[model samples]
Target: MLEIENLHVTVDGKEILKGLSLKLNVGEVHAIMGPNGSGKSTLSYALAGRDGYEVTQGTMRFDGEDLRAMAPEARAAMGVFLAFQYPVEIPGVVTMNFLRTALNAQARARGEKEIDAAQFLKAARAAAKTLNISEEMLRRALNVGFSGGEKKRLEALQMAILKPRLAILDETDSGLDIDALKLVADGVNALRSPERAMLVITHYQRLLDYIVPDHVHILADGRIVKSGGAGLARELEAKGYDAVIRSAA
Candidate 1:
């Protein structure tokens, strides 16, 4: 569903991703493991079309759409979802209201009618319950005063409700505890479908145990140095990234 080739991204004035290429098809989940500053998050930003991460060279196609030409909102409207490592707090906007507006905007972008209040509540309730997002939590301002786990679950709730074709999770597992990590993973796994794909960027393999990626990739020095099946993650964990990088080299 997504294709990237020779993607070079520059944040500020320094290049982060150099000649990175990868493809994710529908019905697959890919895990990208790399050390800090190895361009893992940069790859996610480039995919989400975040501003200031200029794509100096490369072509990204999302189901045949020229991904680079679309704005971040357009990318989101076109079924791209990004879960940030640190979710921002919007003190003035209730979570429900924010979700409502976002879902409505996406529906309109896809040429579908806006969902009604009753239908939205029904969907949100089920999704939130599975993610352990309480109705009371929904009434609070977006991510405002939520615990780290709560914020991550909120992101999962958004993902489930929107059902994006391609979900880019940028360190969604960072601050989560064991139980919270399981909850977030369950929420993500519940939304997986034949038509949906996920790119999970993480530093630890512990997240992979819960998410169970279909493929594991070693990203070093801003590019994918090695790709393999699920066993690759376990191997990396046992040997460490330094060994893995050298092996790839």
Candidate 2:
């Protein structure tokens, strides 16, 4: 579970998120819909404790702990995962190697012993298969020369393997074709459980068709202006964000 209270964030001295607040409970799925420059991505980065994005005024709590005081790695170790919109390409970093390192790092932080190579391989292989990613793909450099869809699938692979308690997907549906989108959505759906929560950030309702959220939120000008049920998503898609914004206004 996670809670944000009056989250006001700034980047390069420009305010982006102003008095934004939301609460998510375990096993619940929420979708954040907004127009461009609505500070959706900023909220994700700020919640993830990414550097450079200053949290001028606000408090973010993850499972009752103050997330603002913790480092990014600490947040990740505490079961917070952020699926980035643009997955960076890291040449010379084999996908498997990077994954193992990340998994081991989190495990160690939690005082858990690192998994053996054989066990890691078995789990990774199974997860990759579920995501329709081949071992050959995992053997290559991380995100290097991979298609947009491929990168998104790789993100899902990581998510499945990590099994974070709270996952924040920042526009994972962007730039994905129908097939790729479905694959990613399936992966997300497969990971949904009573112990986890998800915040899906997207502009279109098409992705919601696959991952139907329990709640829908409309964010505009750095604040959540509207909150509704699944029907709100359909209404927004049918009429566009202008209607929602005007109605909220």
Candidate 3:
């Protein structure tokens, strides 16, 4: 559902992703494991069409549509969802209202009827419950004073309600405890469908255990150095990225 070819991204005059190419097909979950400064998050931002992530070269297409030409909101409306590693706190905006507005906005953008308030509230409540989000938390300002786990769970809740075709999770496992991690992973796994694709970017292999990916890729210095089946992640866990990167080199 997503295609990126020879993508070179520059952030603040520094080239991050150099000649990176990846294609995620429908009904697949791909894990990208890389060390720090390897441009893993850069890839996610570029795909989400975030400003300042200039695509200096190559092309990014989402389901045959040019992503580079689309704005961030347009990309989100086109079924692209990004779960940030550090979710920002939007003070004064109630979480439930924000979610409902976002969902309905996407629906309207797609030329579909907006969801009724009653229907939206029911769906949102169910999703929040599945993610272990409390009613009080939903009534609070978006991500305001939330624990890291709570913020991540809210991200998953948004994903569940929106049902994006391509979900880019940028370190969704970060700052999660064992229990919180399991809850978040379960939420993600529940969204897996024949028409959905997920790109999971993480540093540790522990996250992979919960969300088993169809393929594992080793990204280093802004490009994918190796691609393999699920075993590749275990191998990286065993030998470390240094050894695997050296061997791949």
Give the per-residue lDDT of model 1 (tens digit) for 1-249.
899999999999999999999999999999999999999999988888888999999889999898999999899999999999999999999999999999999999889999999999999999999888899999999999999999999999999988899999999999999999999999888888899999999999999999999999999998999999999999999999999899789
Q: What tens-digit string does per-residue lDDT give for candidate 2 at 1-249?
A: 799999999999999999999999999999999999999999999989888889999889998999999999999999999999999999999999999999999999999999999999999999999888999999999999999999999999999988899999999999999999999999999999999999999999999999999999999999999999999999999989998899999
What lDDT score goes with residue 106 in model 1? 95
lDDT of each: 0.94, 0.95, 0.95
Please identify which of the two predictions, 1 or 3, would achieve the higher TM-score against the true structure.
3
The total of clashing pairs for model 1 equals 0
Q: Model 1, 162: alpha-carbon shift in Å?
A: 0.5
Whichever of 1 and 3 has more lDDT, that candidate is: 3
Clashing residue pairs, backbone N/CA/C < 3 A, model 2 = none
Give the alpha carbon lDDT tens digit for every residue of 1-249 in model 3: 788999999999999999999999999999999999999999999999888999999999999999999999999999999999999999999998999899989999999999999998888888888888999999999999999999999999999999999999999999999999999999999999999999999999999999999999999999999999999999999999999999999
User: CA RMSD for every model?
Assistant: 0.7, 0.6, 0.6
What C-alpha lDDT, on a 0 to 100 scale, does residue 203 get in candidate 3? 98
Off by more than 4 A, model 3? none
Give the TM-score comparing model 2 with the true structure, all chains together. Answer: 0.99
